[model samples]
Target chain A: MASPKILIIGGGPAGLSAAQDITDAGGEAILVEQEGFLGGTPKRLHYSLLAPDLKPVEEVLDPLIDSVQQSGARCMTGAKVESVNSGRNGFTVTISGGGKKVEEKVDAVVVATGFAHWDPHKKYEYAYGVYPDVIDFKDFEKMLSDGNIVRPSNGQVPRRVAWLLCVGSRDRQVGKFYCCRLGCAVSIKQAMEVRRINPAIDTYVYYMDIRTYGFWEDKLYWKSMEEFGVKYIRGRIGSINRGEDGRLIAMAEDTILQRPSEVPLDMVVLATGMEASEGTRETAAMLGLELEEHGFVKPLESDSMPVSTAVPGVFVCGTATGPKAIPDSITEGSAAAIKALNYVRKRSIKVQARA
Target chain B: MPIHEKNLIEKEDLLEKEKAVVDGVDVSGRWNTFIRERLLSDYHEDFVEEVKSLPGGRTVTNCWQCGTCTSGCCLHTDYGLREFNPRYFIYLAQIGNVDELKKYGDVIWRCISCNKCVERCPKGVKVEEVVHNIDEVLRRRGVTEDTPGSRWDRTYLDNIMATGVLDELGLTLKYVRAEKPEDFTRGFMARMAVKIIRNGNIRTGPIRRRTRGWKKMKKVAEDILERDGYASAK
Candidate 1:
């Protein structure tokens, strides 16, 4: 029968990574992305070496996308699968956009939809929507790209800017107690970016804990704080409000100080947590896959195994499994592709043996 | 030789005194009463029987007190208490000392229930669930509501059952009252004074409960409670 059709959802590092592997393994594949382009958040990110000293997103991803496109795997941009139904043999996926409703049959599916920045609107105390200068880390990045990192209220470079790490993360009150794996390091990277832009800017990171695990621990945290004088305030932000002149005012009980202090800031960027992409729930429902409490597709056995989902035919990799940086996502994506190929090829072998 | 001999004689005298006390008590029998008093109680009996009836209750006894599960837990990550390991709690359950378990009740409540313990457990102990049941035992014993954390959890179902929707203001009030009454006293007076100053509504506070779908939600919540039989005091 026609080469076991493979359909991969999401076009980010995970999706593209899976596509490359699937093509190499001699499987028919279709890679679909909701955005106009293939690269996901890594495209939006302008930080230096996330897993430090690793290849940059542009250097590594550009060629992979090209190779996957050349490998006969059809790339569909701005396409979304509306619904999917699976049977014993294969899956029927209904897609929309490009002025038409189309259907495709695939023998297997890989979910790599990745993750989204956790919404802080639910946290009313943060005054996210009400305050002009309160933006999530991603929005701050976009603002930085456009112009100076100055408060929108006044036309001056920020004297005091605060990064409230773990806004929606590691908070049981909000039902997300699990650490989003890469958030701590990501916050440090962002703070470093601000310092690089304007050395004079007073950067204070309000955190419950600084979880700089592994090699960059000494370099990122110790060097940034002791050597460069980035303030590591030990506390969680209790609330944030807009000041008279429109500057952001943060209220937090500095555990070290043992008193509540109001720090006036030109801009407050909440290093928001990560959650499974919006599409993951829908995709999981269609394919009869399991999702963990945080909505990430539950790994079959994450501790020992790699890139295996609960379902027999379906698999998930990268941030879709949990919050992961680009390098980890790429590695997981390749592992997931190998897992799918093994399943399909094994079935083919069984058939040949039976005959 | 006489001085050395005198020292040996003195050491022998001290050893005789220690042995006299040791011989008066049987080492094996010493633990029997302690175990019987706490372990054979109705609470311990019920906890053990209930756990045994559950899927892996028998496995709780199979634990070798390895302490691996506790070591692997994320609850010990800086904020957590080293003494509050779930594996030790399980061992306590196996030994049947309900009182010792009760003594460590607050620490058990300190568990954020992250389930890292469950995931890492080599023996597949439902660490969170088992600890949750132990917490139930503490609540039944009528321990002081020390913190809003412990009290809210104990009465969470009841609050949801009575009001239908979680009363945000009520929760805050309950928290303030349970944990820090002084903080509550200051906050309450401050709110009242602020209300008088601003001429805000005194009949109710700034945060009001949505009584709209509350009745319906309350009914649904009540049904769940009645089905679970949580309305009555344990």
Candidate 2:
């Protein structure tokens, strides 16, 4: 039988990893990404270092992207998967770009449309978009990668910084109840980086719970405290505004002391959480895949069959299913690749038996 | 609008001019209260390290401030003392904010050792031990003074070390004499001394009686207390 073709819709850690794994396993893979580049959010944001390990982004993603490119899998950049129509032979997929449309026949589909950073502006009290000194995780990553820890307001090294966790995640007022899962570690990592950039900055993280779940509870959160002196205060930020000194002032009740504390800082970092990206939403709609309440692609059985989507011959992985870390996304990418490859094998068998 | 959680602001920081006029405009009382802005704390950076050096304080850093320990605290649920929250105290100590621990020094001693916090704590913080250690540190730093009850305990323990058995009469006399010189004129110690003589409950004599085998065990008890960071009686 000819090589089974698999369509991987995304070019992120998960999509790239899936494409690499499938091609390495002797299955033909076609990778599609909407951006002109292939490296997903980390590349788009120019992420300097990843969390938990603090490895340079290029060390991990660069090789993954390169390996997938060299694996002989057809790759499409700056294009979108317009539609998918299933038939007895397999799926007829439409790709549209540059006012052109191309069709391909694929044995299976893997939707790895990753997540988007939650918009901090939704919590208007934070003054994320309005204030020049305030920035979210996405913007901070880019700023950090640019190698300057200066306030946008004056471009001076910040003397005091405050990281407010749970800006847009774990907040019912915004209709999002699930924990962002990555913010605590991300905030801790950023706080460490800020302090490393300038040892004098008094960095404080105000949080209700430092949910640095998994091994990160010690590796990232506690080490950030013992090694870097990044102070942790049990307080939820009430609001942020410009003070008389042109510095940002954050108001919070240091719940430990049961007294309100007004923290004056040169910069305020909102550890914004992740949500379903627009691509994730659009792909789900186009493919007739079920989405959970949070709009992430619904799995066949999230606990046991996590990579299998609601539609047969279709698989989903990474933040496309929910908010997850880079390592987990990559793992799910390989997992989805294996499932897609198996489905193709079974399809060829069915066709041969029918003949 | 500026966020002023007025209820959470300290009472002393809310300074207001009662019934005053400023520039032909009335600015007085709660209507024009001034909320004092707090400065960043230099934090006793070694506070957690100091606590860990003491007995029963090693796990203080394990706290994540989940409040699970506080939710099941008997001192909070039964005694109705809101200041006796284990989670809050642990967080304060962890942050090295000794200034904030001032208001909570006395309450730390009130821990009943119900161990509810230890059982409920997901981080394995020995909550009961941390509470006692905080009390110990407060007393050592003179943030808290010896209450009459604590003074009585000191006298009682002194008598125990002197003699294997507890001498109630010696305990009473020692406690009375150890009272402040000014306390002699008008205090429970003065009244108690007078009652002891008036009733002839004790013969006026030296506390020469010492329990047998006390020397061997007294050394052990003193060793334990010293090792636990309590080198003195009170």
Candidate 3:
């Protein structure tokens, strides 16, 4: 049998890892990315550090990008998977970008189309568009990458800073009810970075829950409190208004203290959550893949068979499924590759039979 | 606002060992005070379902316990009250902790219906109404005795019914006599009998009474005593 040709959608860490693994295992892989660059959100957003360890982004992301670029798999940057049609024995997928289209026949398809950072503008109460200082995590990370923490309005080091958690995710108003999963840990990490930059800055994190889950609980959440003196307030901000002093005024009820507080700060960072990317939604719809309430692609079985989809010869993984951290996405990428490879190897045993 | 400077958890929930020997090591003092696990025997599974049926309590099930209601609660923010938390009570109600709910009956009715909680609740939980429902549940179950507040209300209504006139002196006498004020001689004098029997200071537990208005006078007493010493307090 000719080695199976596998089509991987996306060119991020997940797609890169999927392509790398399939190529290493002697399977022909075709990786497609919508963006011209291979690196995904991290490169786009210029993320400085990965939390829990606070390791430099380059340390983790650069190597994966390099390996996939150098691998036997055919990498197609600035390309998109236009359509997927399941034929008699395999899938015929249409790839198009830059006004050119190519048709390819593949034994399996892996949808690693990752998520998008939720648009903070959906929450008008925060006044993100109005105030230059009220920035979201994407802007905040870019500022961090620039290596100077300053108020966007004045270009001076801020005396006071605040982070508003649960911006778009876990909110009914925005029709997003799932936890973004990365909001707490990332905000805590960012807060720690701010404190290291300037200890005098009165840093506060307004939150519903400091859900720095698993191993990150101690390293990110508690350490940010105990080590960095980052104040964690048990309340979400009700609103943000411009003060006469050019400071941003945040109104919130301090649930722990059971007191209403109006704190004025030079900079306000909104811990924005994630949602299914437009590409992810389009790909899921195009490929006839099931989607969850949050618009992320739903696997055939979430726990037992995570990578396989309802459509035979198609697999889904990473943040394409739901809100996930970087490492988990990479791990899912490899898992999806193995599942796709297995499906190709057992061409006689149809996954449709199991369905 | 009542300044509750103590915790009922320490008295009621915490179980301490005098000298705890944990795996051949003396993990006594701070480590010894372990919170005893609660029993589900007092848990009424249908209580939450029943509470949701009441008026203004339809949104009782909608609380995600984000603490938004309690955060903006006037009784807490303006009054500096740590107890009477909407989040705390809602959580307790969800888990069917009827025993715990009964203990807070006195102050559960203290909600002034500011609706700050209702306005700001992200989950659309009508918090003030839920609080009212909790108070109603406690009152209907007869778990708490007729509080002094209810007794006063009853006394005032009865005065109106009996004479249909506002007689302040008559109302005061009727209310006071019904309560039956006991003269225990004096403050220190009352404790003299127990102190003499013990031949030392009596080790009574904390008298955790909700000192509402008297707390203001107590602050004044504390300031004067701190500056002038216990002699001035005498």
Highest TM-score scorer: 2
Q: Fnat for model 3? A: 0.00
Runs with alpha carbons beyond 4 Å of true place in candidate 3: A348-355, B1-234
- lDDT per residue, candidate 2, A1-355, as tens digits? 8887999999999999999999999999999999999989989889878988999899989999999899898889999999999998889999998789999999999999999998888899999879899998888889889888889988888887888999888899998889989999989998889878877777888898888888997889888875676878888988997888898888777776666677677888999988999999999998899999987899999999999977889999999999999999999999999999998898789888989
Residue lDDT tens for model 2, B77-159: 88788888888777777766777788776787788778988888877889999877776676777878765545555677777
Ignoring the other chain, what TM-score does chain B have in each prediction?
0.52, 0.70, 0.52
The segments of candidate 2 whose C-alpha lies over 4 angstroms from its true place after superposition are A98-100, B1-234
Would you list the C-alpha lDDT of every candidate in the order shown?
A: 0.70, 0.84, 0.79
Per-residue lDDT of model 1, residues A1-355, tens digit only: 4577888998888899999899888888889888888887767454344544434456877898888889998899899988878775677888886978899988778888888888999888998887767878777766655546777656578877788988788988899978876777767766766777787786778888788778667667655653444556667888997667667778876554344556677788888888887877777777777888777888888796657777777888878877787888889889889888887778777778887
Better of 1 and 3 by lDDT: 3
The deviation in Å at residue A19 for candidate 1 is 0.4
User: By the DockQ metric, which is better: model 2 or model 3?
Assistant: 2
Candidate DockQ scores, in order: 0.01, 0.12, 0.02
lDDT tens readout by residue for model 3, B109-194:
77777888888987677888887777666666777666665566557655443433444445656776677656534464446545
Docking class of 3: incorrect
Among all windows of 10 consecutive residues in model 1 chain A, the one with the lowest summed lDDT is A46-55
Q: Which one wins on lDDT? A: 2
Candidate 3 per-residue C-alpha lDDT over A1-355 given as tens digits, one digit per residue, 9 for 90 to 100:
6888999999888888899999999999999988888878888789988998999888988999888878878988889887888898799989997899999999999998898999988899999989999999999999998889999898999987889999998899999998999999999899999889877676777888878889997788767754675656578888998888898888777564454566677889999999999989999889888898778898898889988899988998889999899999999999999999998888745554665
